[model samples]
Target chain A: MSGKSLDNRRVQKFHWMSRFLSGWAIFRQSFLGKIGLTLLALFALMALCSFIPPLVDPMYQPMAGVDPEISTVTGPSTRHWLGTDFMGRDLLSQLLAGARVAFMVGVSAAFMSVFLGTAIGMIAGYMGKFADTLLMRLADIIMVMPALVVLLMLAALFGQLSIWFIVFFIALFRWPGVSRVIRAQTLSLKHRPFIEAARVAGASHLRIIFRHITPNVLPLSFLYMTFQVTSAIIIEAALAFLGFGDPRTISWGMMLQWVWKTGHMFNAPYWLLPPGICISLITLSFYMLGRAMDEVLDPRLRKEGQTD
Target chain B: MGNGKQTILELDRIVKRYRTKGFFFGAHGQDVIALNEVFIKILRGEIFGLVGESGSGKTTAGRLIVRLEQPDQGKIYLDGRDITGLKGKASKDYSRRVQMIFQDPYQSLNPLLSVFDTISEPLIIHKIGNAEAREDSVWQAMKSVGLSPPHDFAHRYPHQLSGGQRQRVAIAHAMVLKPEFVVADEPTSMLDASMSAQIFNILLEMRRRLKVTFLFITHSLAAARYLCDRIAVMYKGNLMEIGPAEEVLRNPKHPYTQALMDALPKFVHSGGVKRYETLLQAEREVSGYVGCPFFVRCKVARAPKCSREKPPLKKLDDSHSVACFYAEPGIKTRSGGKA
Candidate 1:
């Protein structure tokens, strides 16, 4: 009994150690897929800024001044590098404070879009018939309308739309394209032998879809989610730049909007350029990362790479 | 014929029709009868071979037997139970009893999963054991299929395996559930000649070991002759003949079966004499048609009767049955065009 217990402990240790090693290897390999790694790092940093209080204290707000016209880069030497705006608030702190908001909107929108799109696509492809017809037609109708225009109109009417509301709107518009892709993939996968095997194995319809079908398509969904986040961030930035963002909360886009309105283009390029550069870099990184993930995750592409 | 064994599966007057439309607008839609009143009985522990060419509805019949596709009109009985429209738990139970092995081995196993996980999936779904026991069962299954050492194979992915190894994995996956009846639909078709033989041997071994009944569907008559005890010839969704494998292969009464036998490349003969004559004979016979399905390709086809009226299945001997109008007693020496 003692020997068996020791063996069990050894096996458990081996399993966990292997898992850690594999995870480390994956992390290492991700660095080779440079674009994805950079974006992932940025996203991680953004997440970190949200939970870490000192990283994003309200005292570091850059643009919190009584006279809005006065532009000065002056703050605490060690903590606030970008200095204070018109309100003598630290720019670094405000930027850090806004990280959580950006991540919340981006990730929430992506999750909603992916969930709804994948479910709809799987249902349409697997069940087919009238359900497919109706859903696809609805998707088409939604796709025809200009998404940005609708979002702008909605935001204007709502007047300082909540983060969740913005996420909902973004997701509602974003799902159509992903739905089509996922539907096509699901349609092909439905006819595969594994699905038939699942059927013959006495698996229920829901079980087959969730267990067999969903896992097969999950990597593709993940890749698409990354792309979705990049798009969501851009859209959120665009909305904020156009003055539809929450006035009370300062985001990267809000920073850009402030810079543009105050006509800082002549004197201080640094203030406007930092947020703009960050936005472009983050989006580009995500796109590159998504492409790399697509290549790696897809078995067909992986096989091709192996052969070559 | 008089053994009177209990039928484990039966397809009574099954019919499956598919509606097809043209690519262009306003093109007339037509109904293609994929299976027209097809009937067959599979006895318990019997390896019943369903042999046919492409589009013969053999795969469709196999699908119907497993309830993967519901037949338009039919009653399917499993172990004297009416499973025609069984749903939910009843259907699931039926599925567990009767499993199906698909044609392509490559597509049969999920590409993403490891060998152990793939084999253990059914056990997991059926709640056969806890995690530890399920893993043990998976390893046992892998070892049984000659994928040893089991530990080595369990960790390896699908792409790492060869075609034959992949096929073995697929078979292991199917057999892991210990199903009573298995429908191996052209399981060896995609395999190489040597690999095909290996798979056939493995299947035979599995049958002996597990005592599992198999409905082996194949287009290859040679394969059917080797593995199947009884063979059923299918022509355009119709069961033309069914009998002992040796009897069907050696003395084929159906013209389609005879033609198929003749089409097999003889080892001794070369290009000129035997080959051309066989080809010419096949073409001449296949050109003329009547009511019988094989009439279009029968060397010994009669005039009006063969074309006008469909031949019902008639028992020729104790073990053999042929669906030919002229399958009468002591009528073997009929005047023919070519021997």
Candidate 2:
């Protein structure tokens, strides 16, 4: 009996492994997926390396530490790999720290929104009639307001915004889009026979929503999360570049703000271009990742003969 | 076997209608009657078959019994208790005694859940036992459904199993709770001949072992003849005939029931087969809900009589009744039809 049970466990593990491997195989076939994965890996390495520079020399810190010798913006040299900023902060260390911030802001904001959106969408869909109309109308109202513009208004009202507050605001504004997608998925899923079977088996409304509907809608929610991450990163970058960012953090947008404020936008390409390029590249990689995942989740997008 | 027996479930004048969602304004779509004043009484420990064509409301009757949908009018009684408007805990308690096996095995089982999880769900919901006891119950249920060596099939998902295997798993799910009444809605409609026979045997075994009453809804008269103790023929949301399976097949009274028997496939080489010749080749055009539901295609239907007023079910003999104005009971013994 124990041997048979062990075999059952092995079969389950094998099935999961094979499913993951097949998904990976499909993910590898897309050029965008390959490029995005590589670029994201490079940024992850940069985020990891951000801690190394400050440890090597205190002056190499992206924020408070400043070079004693170099007081003004300068071109790249043997000493300063990417030169110094107007405040004499190391641009290389700042760009690396910017990668860390971009990942932090993007993933966390996306995760929070996706979680909130999935829960709300399932509730609205499964409990139709009044709750459906009210929640969906609320989503419609939130979806129409421009996230960046609203965040700007709030930033202006508050004077200065914290990093966590920015992430939270981004999550709040972005959830409507995810909620709409998740709600549509949930609507279709709630009518399936399996859901009716659960109801007939004496499962409560709460049990049906959490135990049955949640697992089915979770894949779609995950696919939407990747897309949400791209928007979150872009929104955060736009806010930071507009000078509404937190004062303490050394993000890519904050780096670009410093370069533009110090009148070094045209002269110092080394100081200005790194943060601008980093912001664009990170967002592009995340967008590519989302597109690739969309193909994985929706089998209709896959080629005919490629099915396992 | 059902003579003078206890009544387990009953449907009294159940009416269900559905309306399509109209435009945002005040426009309303016409109501489609799914079940029209349908009445049925099921005997305890008997497999009562409800046979009909598509859109004939046979499935609706089964769904009503399981409380998946409430009747628009009238009431449903389970064991002499009116259970039409049960709510919350009452509804849950009702579900403990009544369960359902849905049509389409592929669509019935949740793909995310394993066979063990699916079968044990009711046990967990009813708080039947501890983890070990639930496991034991699931094993017993699976074994009764012919899924032997329980651990081998327990962890498998619906996608991994064949249609027959999936349906057996579905049966295990319904039987694990040991419900007294089960509504099996076209359980074998999606399977092949051999697989369907296997499912039929499993259902019979369940009834014999557990003494569970069943409402077996199907479109196949042949299958009903093979499995049901009593059968009811429905047409366009109306019950046409109700009788013992052998008596109905051997001596059909209603023209619609005769038409259903005539439509069954027979061997070309068979000699001297009696034909009912009761069905009109093309359907007669009729407007509105009036008269007999089968009047449109019934060849025996008389103008101004069958087209003007509906015929209520009249008792023919002991435990046999049919709904027809001109039905001749025990006169036409159907020849060359095998049970």
Candidate 3:
């Protein structure tokens, strides 16, 4: 006769990992998650090809487009494709390199924001009192700051920062909104009857937060992540456009900076239009994907479509 | 009253209070006494009914017994072990022995969990068996609660089921572990009259087969009469009367109990006039050595002593207990007579 509970082993079997796997499954089935992953996959393929010389472009040799001598500076042509900038760089090749940078910045910054926001928000929402007030007020302070000014200050202080540095820096401003939403969710979710049920069942605080609250907020974090990626890309573009871009790496915003500085605004529609359109499409894809993911994940977060 | 018949669960001087937000900053928050010096002993294999009005603390007392909420000043003993101080593993082990069925079926069962998952959750939480064995027990539990062809209902979420089916799922969840004592907090109050009756029968069957002791909390005395062996009537957080269900309903002692019986609508043409008594200022006045909580609305209240002293739960017979100073068993109840 074992002097132990028959149910103890069974209860312990319910690990947090099982729920996380289930959450990923649910997100995968979502329409936005599907399209978002697909678009991201395509970008990832392009980014991977960017490392190879011949793979990026068959006609132009590696670093050939950068020189002002190899290609003629002209408006949209059949030979040059998206024509050439004042520096004689291929706008199409520069755009491809920009996509790689966009993907990196967007993804890394979004990951940082979501991870910090979730941790901060979950703690504030679950802990209550002093911790709650402290974190929420911190978020409030960050949320009210002007995004452009903060980026400008950072860029001026640390000239030509690496892509990862910009990613982490931008993420600092990005976390407040996510934290606010997640904290609000944790507040409301904590009061749910099931949460009470779990507590009464002798579930530890950490167990309830990770097993219950975490899964519930995951879809929300994911939906926010998509929007975060979109904003991250735009923010990076804006920084690059303002001449804070790294000289070593080329991006859509860097191309726009070149276009503006060269005084080829009206003359080179080929140079100007490509980067702007790419930026719009990338942002649009994320927003569309986010909305669709929300619709599938949580109906409460789902915004009514135009048809409604 | 057999020698071997054990008391499965007992509450001694249980007091629960909630602090309301203060009117001003740094102001002392007012405490709402949800239960006051309450004591109960639920015998093994018996459906002990706790009947009262909406704000009478029936649910609070139920929650306290199962350790859902800690009592401000009291001790909860399960099978003669003081379990209120239990922590971590010991507390979880205690949870295995004492389970609860909440009032709202829709809110009780997690929306994301399927019928099978909801029923199996307790077993899963308690670490009962392997997956195959757990599934076997789950199907048996579901069948016992009348969820036939368990396979068809296993994958269906709570939103897909009817009110009765959902409550059945809730019942299956509570009884799956075969707990020694279960506190059912108004299990059928949320359902329609017909559905409520079916749910009650299922509860009765589970009680019969499992021999599980129950602290049944409900506002409806009629449901209590149909299910309980002994009934405890409460009012404004005070136990008004406790006796055999048939005796309490057939011949009520407390005036509040009489008022409750009088309020029941009867279609028969009988000229039995009902008297109304304005309950003395007992509404929301929680703290203080304040008199009887029901004195303000008591129909048979006389002297001001009731307003000055809180009545203690006193035993009148081997099986009967009343908390009122003026409660006399011989007195004929005006309403609920021969109808």
lDDT of each: 0.76, 0.88, 0.78
Candidate 1 ranges beyond 4 A from true positions: A1-36, A39-59, A63-100, A263-267, A298-308, B22-28, B129-140, B269-290, B328-339
Where is model 2 chain B poorest over a 10-residue stretch in terms of lDDT?
B330-339
What TM-score would every model get versus the actual structure?
0.86, 0.96, 0.85
Q: Write the per-residue lDDT of candidate 2 for residues B133-189, one digit (tens) a residue.
A: 888899999999999988778988898899999999999999999999999999999
How good is model 3 by TM-score? 0.85
Better of 1 and 3 by lDDT: 3
lDDT of 3 by residue, B289-314 (tens): 37877766564554467778888877
Best DockQ goes to which candidate?
Answer: 2
Q: Give me the runs in candidate 3 sitting further than 4 Å from their true place.
A: A1-64, A67-72, A292-308, B1-4, B268-289, B333-339
- Residue-wise C-alpha lDDT for candidate 2, range A147-167, written one tens digit per residue: 999999999999889999999
Q: Score the docking of each candidate (DockQ).
A: 0.40, 0.63, 0.29
lDDT string for model 1 (B1-339, tens) is 346867788888899988787678877588777787887888877788999999999999999888888888978778878787998888877776888888898898887676766887888778887777777777777877788887667756677788889888888888888899999999988889999998888888888988888999999988998999898999888888889898888777766676677677777554542221212244334343547766655656676787777888888887788888766543551335643
Q: What is the TM-score of chain B alone in each candidate?
A: 0.90, 0.95, 0.91
